[model samples]
Each structure stands twice: as structure tokens, then as C-alpha cells.
Target: DVVGLDGAWVNDFAKQGAIADLSALMTEHDYDDSQLASQVEVDGSTYMVPAVNFVYPLYTNDALLADAGVDAPPSNRTEFADAARAITEAGDAAGTAMPLSLETPSGVQNQVMSWLWASGGSMLKDGKPDLTNDGVTETIEYFDDLYQDGVFAPGAFTMKEQDMVEEFTNGRVGMMVDSLAHLTMIRESNPDLKFSISALPAEDGYDGKRGIPYASWGLGVSESSDHKEEAWKLFEFLMSEDANAELASMAKAFPGNVASVPDFVEDDELMSQAFDIYQAGYPANEFTGLPVAEDLMRQMNEQFQAMLEGDITVDDMLETTQESWSAEF
Candidate 1:
């Protein structure tokens, strides 16, 4: 049986206004926060329940770092580049070394958004989208520098989520930002490898800004599903502190619920090593969630690529960004 449910289908349905709610067809069912995302707000009520939550996280090839003579995880953007440069310069990788491999489409968007957050970008003000600030420009400039300098994998523009993970696992790339769920796969494939996780680094010397792409993966119920009752039962179970912990433990990903991190996971050294990051994590939700105001991030990816590749000037990028988001946001 095919679910026939996805963003493409949803968007098409939304266009024709043909999507229907099946909640009435199914009896009442209960689900937790984990299942919440499968259902979305419809007339102020939930519709479908999700079974699992996927999170975007960073995975580094510590082996590569060591071979390149890097003593520890990069402390800042400069250090990050230095490590990547060292690995590539030492001839570890053929002519290509991806210091940063952004795999998931959503993950790519989040990575760019983090730059805005880290650089004091004002995405929301008084609960509305506000892109009129300096942060957005500053972040775009930074990303432009990264891409123009050839720090990222050339194929990053078209990489699938799983393929990105395989890049790091197969020793092709030095770092990867992908689903936290794959940590288990990585552990199994390379038991002796050293890896670490923490908040993504913000712009260099931006002490006030800490980089985080929260809302990695969350459960939401679908409003069109008939099996909502049974789904909700599973949803609630998934969001349970018990279930969340087990998933986080098994997936090696951070927990969505701030109160529900699993015990099996070790403490985050990145947060411990850097106070700005720790403080950022503490007040991390400053602009949490992809609020309706912020607009869907897919457009951000398109604009960033254009901005980075010289297809559009920075001002052009800004103009297009404003135009793209002006109406909906």
C-alpha cells in the first residue's frame, strides 16, 4: 500500500482545495507530541499523527581531523575552515574535500537559517517576519564566502540525505549535517571512530549569537487520515518521555522536547567547551520553529544558491528574497 502522502502531494492538494479531512471516518485516538506533526492545525484541531521524529545534527570525521593534525573539534568558523583546509591540503582526499556537507533539503535550509540567527538576524519581531535587518545580509555574505571559496562539496546542491551521510561514513567528506537518526548506522559501520555532537557553530566572534537549528524533526498528525484514532495512540506514545528518550538514545540525535533527553546519551562537550554556545543553547528558542511568518525555507535555499554562485548579486539576492517572501510572510 502506498501512503501517497508527502509535501508534493500536499501542495498539489492545497492548490486544488481538494484535500479532505478523514478524522471523522476514524474513531477518536490519542497520540503524544511525537505524533503531533502528522496532524496539523485545522479549524483549531489536530488531524493525523506521526510515528517518529527526525532531527538534523552534525557528524564529524574525527579520524580525518586527527590525520590533518587538528587537536579537537573546531571552535569557530575560522577553525572549521582550518581543519578542512588541513585535511584537503594533506592530500587525504583527492582534489575534493567537503568541509561541510549539508545533506537533507530541510537541513540545508536550517543551516542557512542558523547563520541568520547566529549573526543577530531578526527573523521575527513582535511575532511577525522582519527581514529588514542587517543579520540577513551578513549571513548571506558569509555563506557566499564559503561557497565561493570552494569549502563545500560541489555536489552539495543535489545531495540526498542518505547520500550525504554516506559521504562522511565512506571517508569522502570531512563533516556532514544530516539526520541524527543515522548515528546508529555510523556507529555500527565504524565502531572505533570518534564522533561528536553539539550545537552548530555560529559566525566567528559572534558571542551574542549561538547557532542552532531546533525543530529538527517533530511529529505532526495529518488532517486527512482516517486512522487518526489509532495514529494518535501511537503519536502520544512516541512523544512520551519514555519513547522520546529511547529514540534519542537509539538514534543518537538530540531530543525535541527540552525536558525529555535520554540518559544514555553523553554530555555535550561542545556546549561545555564554548560558553557562547552553551548560552545560546540555554536561550536557544529565541526564534524557534518555522513559524508561518518566517515562510517555508525552501526558497531560502534557492536564493542562497543563487547568491553564492554569482548567478545573482547580493543586492539581487536581497531583492529576490524580499519579493519571494513579501506576500506570503
Candidate 2:
């Protein structure tokens, strides 16, 4: 009864024979395979029922931005930096905290990937590391500059995702790149927190486009389960249209069932922004659906965090990561 195995873990679990195939269950329930995100499969077998979908986007505290004289969210990285600087400065004057905050490890990995994707770069070009590309290099450079200039909150190099959300919810940060789950938390905790949402900004001085980092949570039953049939029956019920819509509402996630997808795209402006990014969302895992995909990402993210902390240069980080990914791939 695993509730939420990451989508990236599906492949490794399938390879390890740890999860039962849900393909038959899907057919019996009349679940259209075509409606699912492609990450649900491994070697032509469906191993999990996707329950929640998410995308990472820039969430701004509009009150902080207005206080800093920023009229709108930045369209690109240069403006983002400028706005961050202004907000930081103003926050300083007002005895507040930093304007930008980022998560370490997993969440920071997503943030960095957005920068790469915005510049037409990917960590995996064809199931192998592409860390040495211009997009990756420049993205690291920009983050390094921001860190050195004291743009991001102090200790951001080690903060976890929940830590970042705590900072945002407490009005300590003007902007952050995070998932819809945080939005729900913020609203429930502080309904008056003035905020706006937008796509992640592009690389500094680049006009490529904004990028969204999307991921999912799915249900997987152990292959050794004596009641795999019962487990899959539960999966079917959980992923059913009404159940999915209700779950999405509670979690502030997109329903995995395509038939219930419209429930998330409401008339609200925030929902509109979310829908725009979700429609254009890209998988954070460049080698998604591959064996050890999540492990590879974790390895690279650890190295990337080191780069952010100035423990290693971008070139050295890329070279080391390339070797590790090559060995794994």
C-alpha cells in the first residue's frame, strides 16, 4: 500500500521486481493509457497509477515586490536579479529578511534544471549527462554570481524544501520557485499573504523562453503481494475521476485522470498561471523512465550544491558529474 512512490522510482522498482504491473488493472478499469504521462511505463509495462502531477514555478510575494518598486515579475534572468536586488535592499531597509530563497538537494535541483531548460539545455541529451553544455555552464555561473552577491538567503545551500516554504510563508522571502503544494500550505496558513505566480525566468540576457519543471507521485504495489489484485483495485478507486478530482483539490495538484484535469484550471488568476505552466511543463528528469534515473539526479544535485557553495567550479563539477553519469548509464 505504498501511497506515493516517485515517478522516477518506477523504473528501478520495476527492474528490481518490487512493484506489480498495473497494465491489466488499467485495462479492466477502462483507464486509457494514452492519458497518462509517459513516465508511468517501463519496458512497455505500467507499474504504477499516477495520482498527482506538479510543476515548479516562480511564486512571488507581490507585497514585497511592490514595496521594492517592482511592478511585475521579471520576464528573464537579468530582470529577476535586478528585482531580487531591489527587494533585498528594501527588505533590509524595512528590517525584513532576504528576498530570494531556494531549497537544497531536490528542490534546488529542480530550480537549476529550470534554468537549463529555459536556455534550451538539458542535463540529459539522450539518456546521458549533458552537464558541459552552454546552458548548464551559464546557469551555474548565474547562480554562483547570485550567491556571491548575497542575493539568495544565507544558508540556502543547505536548506530543504520545507525550510524554503517556511521562509516564504513567514514573509521572509519575496520570491521562490516551488510546487503547488506550497501554494496550498501558504494559503491555508496565511490567506492574506499577497502573492503572484509566473513561469520560471530564462537565463540572464537570453530570450529562449520560460521553463516549467514537472514531476508526479504514483501508487505502486509490491510484486510479492499476495493480494496484488486487491491492491490494484484500490489503485483503480484512488485514480477514478471523482476520487482524483477530490484528491487534486485537497493536495492542490493536477488530477492524473485526464477526464478530471479541468478541475484544476479554474477561473482564478493563480490557477490560470498554473495551467499555463502545466500545459508547457517538461520533465525534470532528462532521462525519465530510465533505470536509476532518480539516483543519477541525486548524485548530480549533490555536486551541483557543492558548486553553488563555491566548493567546486562549474567546469570541475560538470566533468566529475559527466564521469559519474557515464559510469551509471
Model 2, 1-329: lDDT tens per residue? 54478766777888888887778666776767665543466767777666777877788888888999999987688888888888888865221122123222465356666667755567666555677887788877887777677767666555667766778887888888777767777899898888889877876565543445766777878888887667777877777778877887776677676666555567566976787676665444444466676566667777776776778998988899889878875
lDDT for model 1, please: 0.52
For lDDT, the strongest prediction is: 2
Q: Candidate 1, residues 191-211: lDDT per residue as tens digits?
A: 776766645656677676454
Root-mean-square deviation of every model: 6.6, 4.1
Superposed model 2: Cα runs more than 4 Å off: 1-4, 21-32, 41-46, 93-104, 118-120, 204-211, 225-243, 262-268, 287-298, 309-311
| CA displacement after TM-score superposition, residue 165 of candidate 1 (Å) | 1.7
